[model samples]
Target: PPNGAFRGFGAPQTIFAVERHMDRLAEAIGMEPIELRKKNLLGVGSTMPTGQVLTGSVGVEECVRWALEDSDYEAKRRTLGLANKPVGGRKVRGIGASVFLHGAGFTGSGEDRLKGAVELDLLKDGHVRVRSSSTDIGQGTETVFRQIAAEGAGVPFENVSFAIPSTAHVPDSGPTVASRTVMIVGSIVGHAAKELGERVCKEQEAGGGSFAEASNRLIEREGPVVAHRRYGHPAGVKFDDATYTGTAYPAYAWACDVAEVEVDLDTFEVDLLGFWSAVDVGRAIHPVLCRGQLDGGALQSIGWALCEEVQWKDGRIVNPRMTTYIVPTALDAPPFHTHLVEEAYEHGPGGAKGIGELPMDGGAPALAAAIEHATGIVFDRIPMTPERL
Candidate 1:
């Protein structure tokens, strides 16, 4: 298979499968699909199929609650029965929803062995510079890192500048995948900034001066003040890959999505009417960006459920062009309501965890469930195409 690197990697595919199956299950049980999912929701002590116990900072239940309430899921489900009649002589309506989980940092022992470094450069003008190897893949990582540094260093946000990643300039912070940037690299940066602050404070205390005086003295004495810290996992934690029955993730992020769709029965086309999702991001350093992530992930999951597909012909993607490979357009995307639920983790920097992949996990299942509720038909295929419906 000819493969190219992709951001979401496997989650979008897995979500599609799970969502389609939920719809099937609803049909077999003669129950609303969303009800089925609510009964089977994963919780803090729930063991994933991989046998990893969700021991730390589990918020899947909360994600579901937010989605259901915000979307008026139950009320709409009741209304769906009345609205089941054909509309416009050719229209049908349905609703579906899904919930998903994402592992923060590297899965299992990866973070335990993570050796990322971040440096705080204190300049003569009482400003700070953050240096790390984590890449900003349009995910606002740099902006978040700066915020972490600012909070840790007790300096104004504008007084911080982040150095671009380069082999010659920064330490290997590991690859920016699996939602590790904020949890791992952000922690390293926070620690470095804190250490720098402490060092300056101590220098001032020893010289009978204030924090500001110490900072100025350090800059004068050291030219450019610099502090470095390394982050790694604790010893003895391990996992077995062959068994797929080990600690899957050091920490888990949870999300719930509720999707409302209007189905055109004559054409069998699903129209996304609205979306709502909630995430447990531990702490939202920047609430705007956190909500943005949830909104964006929900939309992406919506695409996987109702529209996006990679058409294959003879083991190659036949529909490579945007025209043929359809994703959700503005008309396809509905208004989204996102809520951030913060549950602090002990080991995270300032009690903050990762939110990167959390939002994408729940959308498909929720949407699929909604569709079954509205149409009284189970859709058991990815893209939920008109032909399949």
Candidate 2:
């Protein structure tokens, strides 16, 4: 089947379903729905259903805690759930929340087997060229790579030029997905650059000259001085696709979201009131871009939860055009409060981990839970439309 490439992949489907289920669970138990999530949320050292123990960097628990606290989730839940609220209004209030994890790099041993490579060509002018097979994909990858290379090589960021993926020029770096470019490829490039610098320094010492002079000498003799390396994870990690089991990912990135919604009981029209997200990104190379990702993902998730629907009639989409297939507009989007918590991972380059998929994972669930809290109706399906409600 041909499916759109979504960062959250199928996880959003599960999150939508689970958020609805949490609403049902809350209604049945006469408990606050957000409380239910807080109670059952996954955290560090938590084993996923696949039995993969989170032995590496874990931050979902902190994300959830910060999100809930910052959003004043409990107080809002109480106000939205009042029994005497009018039923015919065009808008009603709701609040919901969800937590999610993103696996860094390729799943399981894919990275180890591929042995992703990066190269640094040290020029005579003290500048360098970073060669790698990774594509930027508008993810601020090039900037981060430059930063890593400069820091590693003890040079200025502007002194490095990156060569984009070309099989004829660069080594095979793994595909650019799973938020692996920074942690995996960046590390390899940084290491190679550092090694090249060390070699230049060593040659300078041996020849009784400065590093700059030795680098120039190497360039004169060898055209261009270069360093190359390949990288992989530790051995023995594996994933099982059939059962969605095994060590699904070697490392996980975690996030938590809280959504406030206003719903119309008569028409089931929903409006976002406010939203907040907390993410533990291991380390944010660019704080602004990281928050933008969270904001964008949250809006996308909100679209999926409340308005955007692939309407089906007899197994065919009835509404495929943008006119009918709705997404969240600026008016539809609520205020967002985002917090980034850095939990440095020892293994990641410069203590960095993945954050790309964390934002989308929890948006739908949180909104759905919020809606249920407001309306006292449980929603299981995604794209909760007025007709469904």
Candidate 3:
């Protein structure tokens, strides 16, 4: 089967391996797993294998610490036992956590080559419109762009509008993927809006009139007032695409997830009791929307960790429908508690980093770790069905 891109790209699968290894290492050394994790966390000065030195906004440690504290992880671990133990006749409890990072925007030279661009159209009524081929796809792309445009234009948020992205009407700002809508494209939108705002202010100074009146005059005289901007890598940031090295992404969002689970020995069913997540998303432009992203993405991760799977038979898919291929509904989701850690990235719009996919990278490994804590059985494969258990 041909592999295509999905949420988190391949980050979740890689994170599961790394996090599970952390647990095994802790057990081998007879140290607290959380302590071991904290001791090895990357900080601002740490360098990646790609030759990129993390110069700022390295918040993995904070994410881990806050996730632990907010989840009362130590207390839960003590109650659940550091090592596997029988809690009762039919059930056992366990707590596990995973900390990881997700890079914002495209990888390596993706942004460099694409050069996502945005154009701000100054409407005749002193309003501004964002023109870019970046679709919203229900992730609040337009809403966010509007907020950024308004701020950049020094106008009311209501005065800024977003065109329904069309290639004919807007510049090709690249596809709406890699969680780049708000980070990369948004930054471009801000730049264009700022330029437009500067023109309006300049007109106001020369014509001796109100800001809105100057904007109207400029639009009437110049016909169409527009400001265009394009995305560029931060100064000195470089990547070698051929060798797959150096500054893979402009910025990275950090996250930690702690999951508590109860295993029913009689039925071999794993039930998640609670889940807590802490993410360092640079800055959240909209707190509610940010939380919504985390909640939704974490739920998807939880589904992937437990029940979501496709069945194959011979050379064809067996369960291709939702009914046969099971998934978690609202009733099945565990209580979720999400927290945001804001360590502003200097170049991002409102210091915001990508939040859309970060939540998808941690839950699976965290759930697996919890199950390991409960049963003392290290199941290598996912979907940990009763038959496998």
Which model, 2 or 3, shows the larger lDDT? 3
Sort by TM-score, top down from the best = 3, 1, 2
* Candidate lDDT values, in order: 0.74, 0.77, 0.88
- Candidate 3, residue 150: lDDT: 93
Model 2 weakest lDDT span, ten residues long = 81-90
Superior by TM-score: candidate 2 or candidate 3: 3
lDDT: worst 10-residue window of model 3: 81-90
- Number of the candidate with higher lDDT, 1 or 3: 3
TM-score of 1: 0.89
Clashes of 2: 6
Q: What is the TM-score of each candidate against the true structure?
A: 0.89, 0.88, 0.96
Q: Which sections of candidate 2 miss by over 4 Å?
A: 41-44, 82-90, 207-212, 235-246, 312-324, 329-331
Runs with alpha carbons beyond 4 Å of true place in candidate 3: 1-3, 81-88
Instruction: Please state the error at residue 233 of candidate 2 in Å.
Output: 0.6
Model 3 accuracy (lDDT, Cα): 0.88
lDDT for each residue of candidate 2 in 1-389, tens digit (9 for 90 to 100)? 23666876766777667666766777799886667767886666788888877675777678878988898887766666535366555566767777777777877667877899888899866788888888877777777888888888878888888887788998888877777887778778878888987877777788857666888887887886778889866564677767777787666777888888777766777777788888887888788877877788788877877777676788788887889988878777789999998887666668788667667778877776777777777666777788887
Superposed Cα deviation of residue 256, candidate 1 (Å): 1.2
